[model samples]
Target: MQHPLAYRMRPRNLEEVVGQQHLVGPGKIIKRMVQARLLSSMILYGPPGTGKTSIASAIAGSTKYAFRQLNAATDSKKELQIVAEEAKMSGTVVLLLDEIHRLDKTKQDFLLPLLESGEIILIGATTENPYITINPAIRSRTQIFEVYPLTPHDIQTALLRALKDKERGLGNYQVHLTSEALELFTTATAGDLRSSLNGLELAVKSTPSDENQTINIDLKTAEESIQKKTLSADKNGDGHYDVISAFQKSIRGSDTDAALHYLARLLEAGDLKSIIRRLLVTAYEDIGLANPSVCQRTVAACQVADNVGLPEARIPLADVVIELCLSPKSNSGINAIDAALNDIRSGKSGQIPNSLKDTHYKGAQKLQRGQNYHYPHNYPNDWIAQQYLPNQLQGTQYYQPKTNGKYEQALKKTYDRLYQLQNKERGHHDD
Candidate 1:
């Protein structure tokens, strides 16, 4: 009762843990390890409140191993020595080392032997990337797994459980959470379950009970408790993907206003990398062939946006998004390339024509390579009727051009004329 709601609601076993299904789900690596009683040292890295600590605690709980906690930066060698001695006495102990990236060489050297002896199973946790921040010695000794932020659904599950659990949760108090209030708590804290639980506890404790003697947490109370942020969408949340999808679809559908609206949301979220990636993809896939130059300009705009960062970045991003929405749309380039790839993947290719084979070597002429090949530059218009495609795909066509814009229209004309000339030349040979 004295502990924080988050601490009280901590998963006592693996089954009680929320989120990180990839690591804790049935048949997953971690679960398999626990089932077989074969636990190894592992480093779990990801955003805060993503169940890194929960996973470690769950493993220790499930295996009935003694769990010890320590912070690599704050704790001294004496503390580690104490944990090591306990592991020796207990046979096996699960040690959770937080902020592992801050561990200096001195502490690392002391812990390495304990990890190897199988006496202390180290579970290192950090918000930084292990590959870049962690020492190779520690890294090589431990397995690495990335945990993800809790989705709104995952957070909701934990919140509901906390409310109903009479022992560890607020089941003793007759509390009613408005749906709006519940939603605010789940999303407002970005995916930090600890923060969400803390907010829920705050709302429950601060709000006065009504005449019914029941505590009612409304939307306003929830807002004050968690403080609805300017950026409503967490980069890891479903809302983030929704906005990005809307942004790309708006541009593709030629809705300038809608595209701009979604762009503003993403900018507010401060997700510059996602915005840039989506814009470039939209330019190439949606506006391609129709306006080749526009695609080039889009790349430049994305580069500028990346360089400038934020408020100023919004300027170039807005400019390109508007232009992309107003520009003519075509999928012909992507369509054509995919069509060629499909053919090649389906075993449509054949040997290169002898006349078209490379003539870089001395004996290539003896093999009739390039002997009969008509060089396009030697002919009018720098083009000629030649067998360029593999023999089996001699007349196969792939580049289906579009007439959505003047550029593609011109390309279609050129493609059709060349194909006709080549067909006509083949017809003469057939005769």
Candidate 2:
């Protein structure tokens, strides 16, 4: 029986491997390792179908070392032992352990010594965050490198290679894929070349030949085959957070178009919870104080989006994204809190002043609580120049209010007034 097109199309060497130029490119880390014949156990983490397995195969082929494969979740210990025995016999073996995060204590125990002895070069692949999931024992023994989704151009290059390739690919079939079909085939799979190539194989074999004996595959056929397995956006992968980061940053950068673009991607990924969480955070973290009312509006939009699930949810989300992108941006709110927290964590906080302490109890000035405290309501303008912070952090300033929006401008005026009055009463210069 013939193997799948993806299997047959596995790159035989580094040159054949598509994309991942950061690692496998000229003079890159992986390339350097291959050239020096000094390979180490490594974990490749990224979304599915981004050439994790292909990179392992390419490395083995390039080094002319024996390559083996096993699944950390499915394969038995006996299978691992067999591979270990083969490694002993062959002196060295390149083992691709898929789903390395699922590796149990038992399997890991068996592999650790072998990895130490340099008998097995384990290339563990996973779509999960290895730092969070993998055991420290395994992590300490290996380096972790991240892979990324292939670009549309990279996907197109692989598809064309499959079309012309005869021995491993479907070259014998007289197939004619239109430019539109080719574009859809390369792009719809979301950087998964395996899906596109196999979809091409299916399209070629299933589509009947025309009067000219040429199997014609159009955009419709491409859509059917490729979209059947919509990789369901690996939200747990780094790619998900990357899009969220981009979304928030775009809003922070005031690029409405880029912000909406990333928002569309996140919404399409089907995780309303993550999208909402990111939006709420962006409002306070990035747009803080500058446009205070926008924060409440963001909350309202999020409520609406949460109440009505996706497709329709996109409507409210779009409105919030546009508003946030155009809103005056400030990080003063988050920065002030973070700075105060740092002081608290560093033990700079002193005891609360007795005068400012609680006075609602029945002690009746025995401990002098609230003795000298002046009620702000009794003072003019409902404010008083009193020391609220601890004696140690006397003149510490935390909230550096920004004059980005009208609301914050008004706030800054009041803050400046209070600072001047407080500094004079405390016998300190305005800082």
Candidate 3:
């Protein structure tokens, strides 16, 4: 017996394939290719249940070309060779490779000679970003068609047809979908049509068959099946945005424990790489001179993530998040530099003072550029006050070191020495 879901709703033709109208609509690139019989190797990229399989099957059914299917998730290179042998004998072949991203680079490369020789036309399918997941050589030769999420109206129409279409649908059942209940289902499914239909099938199966024949589906039944009530602490979507906002606030407010808790929540939700990246940025931008070593450890965690790649990597990322949160916080350097840059972009372009500009070029000495530039190493204590910035901004201060770390402690003493030199120069001028 056929799977109930597959039996009831497989599209038999291009006209029957729903969504992705951009690719399949009249006179569109893919539609014209199908009609012209000039289709090239391509990859169908999208989330699951967005009709990648259905579109490939429709192409096979509608076109006269020989269609062969291989799943990269299960098939080995040997199995692929068998298909290639058959295709070589045949003049034309359409080889549909599903979950193609799961195949390792070597297995993916096995198709290069065949693709170049025109032994087979390839159609690859994947859910992940093909640029990151596919072999670069294989990717270069194929066209990429993007599938999109189905609209709620399209899903509702499909559900209505499933209820009444006699031969292949649930014609025997009298299913009543309340308006609010339908909206709830649409919202919960997140554009995955297969999950939506499967839930509808289950709801129909579970509803009692009786003389009253009134099947009521409310929000609760829909929620239970889809698990829509669970809250995610992820950072990509709305929940992530909210959670990260709270985490940043905790850090800014100096609540180490609260910041660490939110960081832990993000790590638990499989967002360690992203968490590590943020911590790296925060260490430099927020914890700068206050705790410079925090930046070093955060960068080390990023390297660790590249090395370990998973649940094992989560430990390093979590350690960095906690350490950065507890490290002393300061924004003096961040504020000062940003203020300077903002002035530059907003029509405050400052010229590089002649003293700071390199004077290695021929005849540079004739113009007196770099003529009086101080060599700090030649002076006692290896320090000198010089006009480094533009003449207009000569005395402007941009990097004010914080006092919470060892580097900052040494910086304060140097700053005091520099201040004394400036006052001494002023006193000599008055004399």
Q: Which ranges in model 2 have alpha carbons more than 4 Å from their true place?
A: 228-232, 428-431
Per-residue lDDT of model 3, residues 1-431, tens digit only: 65665346866667877788898889887788889988778899876667887777777667866778889989889988888888878766778899887877667678888888777788898876787778778889899988876777767776677777767777677777778778866656656677777777777777675668867676666665553421233244444655677877777666778887777667667676666666666777788877777788879888998688777886776677677777787887788789899878887667887777778899988887787778999998887766555656655666676777777778777876786676566456559
The TM-score of predicted model 3 comes to 0.58
Clashing pairs in 1: none
Estimate, for each residue in 1-431, the C-alpha lDDT of model 2 and write its tens digit.
98889889999999999999999999999999999999999999988788999999999999999999999999999999999999888789999999999999999999999999999999999988888899999999998999987988998899889889989998888888999999898788878878888888888988999999999998888887776433337677766777888888899999999998888888778889988999999999999899989999999999999998878999999999999999998999999999999999999999898878887879858989898888999988898887887888887889999988988999999988888788788875334
TM-score per candidate: 0.63, 0.92, 0.58
Descending-TM-score candidate ranking: 2, 1, 3
Using TM-score as the measure, the top candidate is 2
| Winner of 1 and 3 under lDDT | 1
Q: Alpha-carbon error at 349 in model 3, in Å?
A: 25
Give the per-residue Cα lDDT of candidate 2 at 154. Answer: 94
Cα error of candidate 3 at position 373, Å:
16
Assess candidate 1 and give its TM-score to the true structure.
Answer: 0.63
lDDT of 2 at 96: 99
Q: Score candidate 2 by TM-score against the native.
A: 0.92
lDDT per model vs. reference: 0.90, 0.90, 0.74
- Full ranking by lDDT: 1, 2, 3
